[model samples]
Target: MTDNRQSLADLASLTNQPAPAAPAAQSLPTSEGDIAAPVSNEPVREPMPLREQILDKQGRAYATGRRKDAVARVWVKPGTGKITINGRDQEVYFARPTLRLVINQVFGITEREGQYDVVCTVKGGGLSGQAGAVKHGISQALTRFEPVLRASVKAAGFLTRDSRVVERKKYGKAKARRSFQFSKR
Candidate 1:
């Protein structure tokens, strides 16, 4: 009986091709006790291009934000930090200090407070959701106005939209996950 299997060297010789070179061994520590890390053969990646500024004819940056069931359309421009929402000032619209703080969080993180004016219209959802939507809108508008702030704002996590929402009610449950009252007859 003839052996059908061939060794790798035999196959390479039959194909008239050179054997593949073995990977380079990792360098050991030097006399100075500096351990050399294994060098990767992969090519270095290029940095991503920076975002460009987006503006309208009126020199305003516009963005839309959504939180829960609320949606807010915001326009940002260079001016004193006056925020108008639904034809009312922020102080009037968002009476609670916490709500106002939530709306201004993006500015605080980017350290751009009082540099841009914001005009927004929010609809649907509750006051809290509306405040969050406005904050998101402001963050987006600010990024569109100044592309350079994108990295810092993104690092602070204001660029991401909040996806948490109210859960749906199940047919047999009183609430999303709460069961109806159990009773003994």
Candidate 2:
């Protein structure tokens, strides 16, 4: 009993308390079938044939576009003077006259003789996003057409994307740039 007491005191002094027994070690079968196999480090990759098409189609006009909350990129290239979007005519793809005007007037490629082909691929946002993408694409195309036009396009605010994103509203707020309901009280 005294030895037990002395040993207990020694354990308490070493461990700062009564020494608790360690948990039993988990026993595993030593058989070969129980061993786990090593996994391969190589990552799986899928073929992107469409992406090649996207890059090849527009090879020249590289654009970056961003709007309220969406951002897209468009590419345009000058070729045999034919304008097409996703293999269809630009007029048919983008039916909005305002959009077309924005493309032609702002990009300065109105002449049929100087044709601009476009290959635009936009992701995120909606119709407006797509339009912004096209605008950005055209801007890039203009820049590519002549490096001198960059300054003019930049000044016109066409090249620079409107990055003004929507501000987060506070609790009980009405809108991003608006205040809550007003009460004279």
Candidate 3:
């Protein structure tokens, strides 16, 4: 048995193969002090690096969200707030009264203190999606300004990324939500 074990080791070394990890002991105590064998061979993943975690946290704290080809850039500054879209005032650029309403609602701003400056640059999507993107961006920027505000923004559903998108359907379909023509003879 000793010679066989030595031969196996020599063969493994010659083949440049690593020795298999030793199996854990499997004996269990019967009303006596003993160790139980590990039940599985799965290797554990290492914990996240502290520096990476910190950077992730910082990124989340001050991040931008884009959607539907519209980009919303938000910065939180100290002062009576204001909002400018493109090079024009938000109200004039947005024009739609209802969108103004949605933006105000999403940002949780009252008529009195809508003063926080939110400068957004959006392109590609129609007016409505741009407004939604801006709302999401502002919500994220606000959370970065105050981590405690995350719950409030999340509860309002403004902080959540809108994942709804156009879906592709089968080749025979007219559109994503449409069906193929009837083939009754």
Candidate 4:
């Protein structure tokens, strides 16, 4: 065994390879230590922020939502199912049941309907766009309040903004995608 070990070392020496060095001891700072551990040469990276860090003291989460020309500023808080849009009750503001449903779709998907109170002020765009914007806002605010629900909400695609917009009319066209009457009489 001694001869075998010596032969291995001798082979390494013939190859001009230095013997392996022992690992250096490093100490991590403990709870009792006020002194920080030595910094490494690598750049220190800041920790990514989580959804929980974006909340107000009153447990309200706020988000801005946009759809086409519509923009909505929304606030979400825990309360009996109450939704106000532009100081009017949701039903009153969104006369169409479909529009009202659009605004509440996020809560329904999370199965958290009637749990949060949502209030929003919307401007620009038509009623349909406004409803879509409110849905986007509610989804965002819900995520901020509880990060865990992000998966469900995101899976429903509520987190993604709809990019569809009206196409611009060409100079020679009567309307977008509609060319002027072709008369070769």
Candidate 5:
């Protein structure tokens, strides 16, 4: 520490040096100051929550969906509507129009029908379970592709997984809930 009064006086008397000029590559940014500020003090409204944006290099959204014992790995891409399952067309794989309808309900709710191409592989369940799993997967993938659709998809209830599984058979029961016929003999 300098105890000298001369050093203290020099520091106090020193003038600021000229600032270096910005490079040609850099320029001072312009600001729009308070252009939208509320004039009245009644209340300053909070900004709305923004939806998360998701981007994929290949322009695809991938998701895994499950229902009962079924699981489906799904991929969605922007294109004319086409749904493929395990290398077969949905029509061929699902057979029934009702099953196809179940898988397409998300698109119906979001009004994005015929907008995306879907390719998925499902395993470990029957046809109905597989269809439900695909529907769940489609809803999840739609949200991932466009987060802004979350509200619509969630409202339509496709984002929620069906957790109901087959009930375990009791040792004394013929089936999951069935009891052996009682005989008074």
Candidate 6:
């Protein structure tokens, strides 16, 4: 039997080509024991393109937000901080302190309290859900008004919509998961 395999050097010689060069050795450390940082061969990445500010002819930023069964339409403009919901002041619309806090959380995180005016209309859900919807709307409007704040607001997890909703009831169940009472004879 004849050997068919050929070494890389033998193939190179037959092809009239020089052998491939070996990888370079790592640099030695200096007498001070300080080793140079390794250089990366990776290409440098370019920074992401910035988002553009969106505004209406009236100079207001508009956005819509939804949570659970509630939906809110919001408009943001530069002014002393004032929030109106459903044609009423925030205090009147959301009497509970916690609800008010939920509505203002975005502003608090951006450290932009008392710097803008917000007008929103929310419907279709209970108080808690409505408050959440309003908060989501405000965050979206703020980002639209000042695109630079997008990174911070997104980092705080306000940009993503809340997708949780009530599960549908099954045909044989009393509620989504509760079973009907059994009868004993």
lDDT of each: 0.89, 0.61, 0.65, 0.87, 0.86, 0.90
Compose the digit string of candidate 3's lDDT tens values, residues 1-185: 46666676888899999654333223544456665755778888985442221113323223466666666766544456577777788789889988877666745632324546666677767888888777787777766666555666777778788987657676878887687788899
Q: What is the lDDT of residue 152 in candidate 6?
A: 92
Query: Which candidate, 2 or 3, would have the higher lDDT against the true structure?
Result: 3
lDDT by residue for model 2 over 1-185, one digit each (tens)? Answer: 46666676788899888754332212333475875444579897875332122234536746666665555565667665455655667688679887666556654643334566566655566656666666776776657655666667777778777776557877777776677779899
Which numbered prediction scores highest in TM-score against the true structure? Answer: 6
lDDT of 5 by residue, 1-185 (tens): 23344455565567554433333313434454624333466776885575665546887899999999999999999999999999999989999999999999999999999999999999998999999999999999999889888988998889999999999999999999899999999
| TM-score for each model | 0.77, 0.52, 0.59, 0.72, 0.73, 0.78
Angstrom error at residue 53, model 2: 22
Cα RMSD, each candidate:
6.9, 17.0, 11.4, 9.2, 14.3, 6.2
**Candidate 4 local lDDT, 51-118, one digit each (tens):** 55478888799999989889999999999999999999998999999998898889889999899999
Q: Where does model 4 exceed 4 Å of error?
A: 1-50
TM-score of 6: 0.78
Q: Under the 3 Å rule for N, CA and C atoms, how many clashes does model 5 have?
A: 0
Ten consecutive residues with minimal summed lDDT in candidate 4?
Answer: 20-29
Q: Which wins on TM-score, candidate 2 or candidate 6?
A: 6
Candidate 5 has an lDDT of 0.86
Which residue pairs clash in candidate 1? none
Q: Count the backbone clashes (under 3 Å) in each candidate.
A: 0, 1, 6, 0, 0, 0
Rank list by TM-score: 6, 1, 5, 4, 3, 2
Model 1: per-residue Cα lDDT at residue 127: 99
Higher-scoring candidate on lDDT, 1 or 5 = 1
lDDT of 3: 0.65
Model 5 segments beyond 4 Å from truth?
A: 1-48
